[model samples]
Target: MDGIIVVNKPKGMTSHDVVNVLRHKLKQKKIGHTGTLDPEASGVLLILAGKACKALQFLKDTDKTYQTSIEFGYITDSDDIFGNKIEVKEINYDFDFEKVLQSFIGPQKQKVPMASAKKINGKKLMEYQREGISNIDVYNEIEIYSISVLSKENYSFEVHCSSGTYIRSICRDFGYKTNNLCCMKELVRTKVGRFTLDMAQNLDEIEIDTVKLYPLSYLLDHIERIDYEPVLDIYNGKHVRIQTNANQVCIYDKEKPIAIYQRDHFDVFKSIRGLW
Candidate 1:
């Protein structure tokens, strides 16, 4: 029960809905999702169960990848097709694909989606926007690693972007450059760090009775590993010293993770979590 489940979230169900279902089905109360996906989006959603929830903060910073469809000539209030239509225009661009791709290359401040979980003054920004509040400061600088137009159908195109970089916002910018409105037609997260959609199971296809769950260690493969026994003195709450070439590593006893150890200035190890 203490591991991660990469759920291929079906469209129309909120991320919270998936968590709630798993909580009931798995009969575990300590379940949490690493990141939130829009109801219209479907793909890799990391669900942490039991004590695995404690490691969420560490995993939150991982990069994400998505294959998205952007439709031109129509804009919506939510930036995606799920929202109310705001405007429509004719697609009349002899688009310079290179310039379009270059526009997203450097650093740019992206306006956070009004329907996102960003907060303002201790209240969610989306709630404030719903109440007619429009002067909120919810913008953040998101770096776009790369953007390649997979296919162009008139003005609609398929693209892939890095984590925190909103595909809808990219469409909006594209529209701004071409004098036509644009909106996201669809989205599917392909990967979150090392986890990919290919390795995920759709909600409807999930056989709870025979589901194969990956151990939490699979997700922590990037972290260095430390053997047990030498840290027995610190397993029960006291910090132990150890020699290492790295600053931090995941300490394990046999095959069970004991805790994450951090190296001191003098090369001593200290537990960060685990050892309950």
Candidate 2:
């Protein structure tokens, strides 16, 4: 029960709902999910149960890819098809979607969606919405790594972005950027770093012993491993020295990760996470 399982989350269930369902089904506590998927969205949801929960930080550092469709003739108050309509415009069939999509390839600033999980004044933005509060003072500096047009008729596209980027905001921005009333119609997260839809299982599909593995295994290409005695020193909360050309590195005791070490501006090793 102490590993990560990919759940192809069903629509209309909050990420917390998935955790509660799995908790009831498996009868194990201490379960956590890497990222929150909107209730209307369905796709890869990484569940970290038991010791795998410790790897949450490692998984959050990776990128996410989603396949989403946008409707261009109408906008909703919630920015998706499920919300109340706020605007409408005639669809423009001649617009250059490719070039418009290309314009958003790099870094950008986005306002946190009103219905998002971001908190303000001790309440989530969504909570604020229910209480008739609508002002937010936060914005996110996010990068859209890549975007490709999947289908022109329905405005389906695949986007790979940094973990915290909001796909709903992208849809909202695209509508205004094009002077159209746009709303997200459908969304499916295809991947979260190495975890993909193909690796996901239903609640009935979990095989406890067979599905769990050390999450740090996904970062092997970017990290150098340590095999010496400092593994125990760091585990015991003692400072230890290690060498690495990378800024952050993971120390391992044979096949198990012991700690994540980082350099002080790439100069000295400092343990960041202790797995022991």
Best by TM-score: 1
Predicted model with the maximum lDDT? 2
lDDT of 2 by residue, 209-241 (tens): 444443545534356777757456767755566
* C-alpha TM-score for every candidate: 0.90, 0.86
- Worst 10-residue lDDT window for candidate 2 reads 212-221
**For residues 96-166, could you state the per-residue lDDT of candidate 1 as single tens digits?**
85578667765678887776678777887678878877566567777776666656653444444555677
User: Residue 186: error of model 1 in Å?
Assistant: 0.9
Q: What is the lDDT, from 0 to 100, of the residue 73 in candidate 2? A: 88
